[model samples]
Target: MKIGLYFGTFNPIHVGHLTLANHIAEHSNLDQVWFVVTPQSPFKKKSSLLDNHQRLEMVYRATKDYDKLRPSDIEFGLNQPNYTIDTLTYLHEKFPNHEFALIMGEDNLKSFHKWKNYEIILENHYIYVYPRLTKVKTASQFKDHPKIFNISAPIMGLSSTFIRQEIKAGKNIRPMLPEHVWEYLDEMNFYK
Candidate 1:
């Protein structure tokens, strides 16, 4: 089976996320896309992050209905400051039968070289990159990288940061998330 690993904090999974996951699953040869909820990204700030379990639950609620979209808490039990290379290695060892690929935005590609053991990641795995503002599609930029491939997803200006800001400002997020997830967020009072 071909599995696409879409790793993110997913503070609150929104339609944009679902759209992208659906796009990848529908257009690509991948069998499923797992949203690997990272406990703490090495390059991002943790101060604003919600608890790992809570984030995982939100992801679960957001993706439960989609057979092709699964929520994964594999990184929750791992050490702090989770790195992509380590997680990929762990998943590869644990699920040897499944072919794993990385799904990320073009924004990440610019700084991917700075990641720990980035060379190994680029050499061994296939990357399905989505387009993003500020990171124009450039074949020359990744000519040296053998596994990188650009994918175009529906354009969405929405983001978790925007959702958080909306919640904090006393604005409703009902439109930003799926109905169940919106209800769950309200019940749990997340980001408030």
Candidate 2:
């Protein structure tokens, strides 16, 4: 099986994330797109992130209806601050029969060199890069890499930070997230 690992903090699984994952699953030739909920990101701030369990639950609730796109807590058992290479390595060991591809945004590809063993990641795993609203594109050096794929997916400008701010201000952002997730956020009064 070919699986695309769409890893993230998923502080809250918003519509943009779901849209991107669905696009990848439908167009990227992968059998599944797993939203690997990171417990901690080496590159992001942890202070404002929701607890991993809550974030994972939100991912599950938001993606329960989708068969190909779903949430994964694979990184929850791994050591923090989680790095992509390490997680991919562990996954390879556990699922030796499956071929795993790393799914990321073009904004991330711009900083790909900063990651640990980036060359190894490029050499071993296939990369599916979805476009983000950022000006950043894939770096020139990696443009011709065979393992990398630049997918033309629907652009979702909505962001989790913006959604959180809207919720904090008592604005309506239900349309920007899954219906169930909005209810979960409301029931928990999260981000208030």
Candidate 3:
């Protein structure tokens, strides 16, 4: 099985997240795009992040209906300050037969070298990068890189930060989130 691991904190899963995963599954050779919910990200601050369980539960509710896309808590059991290389290594070790591909954004592509054991990650697995419009224009930086394949996913620019802010401000966040997730957030009063 060819699985594309879409790693994210998913402070709360949004439509943009699901849309990109679905697009990747349809456009690429990947059979499944697993939304790997990381407990901690090396590059991101944890202060603003929602609890892992809350985030994971939201992700599960958001993706329950999709067959090609699913939520994963693989990094929860692993040590903190979780790095991409380590998670990828663990996934490969556990599922020897399945080919694991790393799903990332253009933003991450620019800072790939800063990751731990980046060389190993590049050499061992395929990196599927989706466009994330930013002033830096890092997408072109690795346009034809051997290990990285640029795939065309939606460019909504929807971010979890914006979603959280809207929720806290009592703005309608239904547009950004899936119906179930919006309902879940409404019921739990998440980020309010």
Candidate with top lDDT is 2
The residue pairs in collision within model 3 are none
Clashing residue pairs in candidate 2 (N, C-alpha, C atoms within 3 angstroms) = none
Q: What's the number of clashes in each of the models? A: 0, 0, 0
lDDT (Cα, tens digit) per residue for candidate 1, span 111-153: 7778999888878889998987565545464755668877878
lDDT of each: 0.86, 0.89, 0.86
Q: Of models 1 and 2, which has the larger TM-score?
A: 2
Tell me the tens digit of each residue's lDDT in model 3 across 61-149: 98888888888999999987777888887888999899999998888888887789987888889999888768346645366779788
* Poorest stretch of ten by lDDT in candidate 1: 135-144
Clash tally for model 1: 0
**Ranking of all candidate structures by their TM-score, best first:** 2, 3, 1
**Per-residue lDDT of 76-157 in model 2, one digit per residue for the tens?**
8988777889999999999999999999888888889899999999889999988877668568888888999999998889
Clashing pairs in 1: none
Stretches > 4 Å off in candidate 2: 41-46
Estimate the overall C-alpha local distance difference test score of candidate 2: 0.89
Least accurate 10 contiguous residues by lDDT in model 2: 40-49
Question: Where does model 3 exceed 4 Å of error?
Answer: 40-46, 135-141
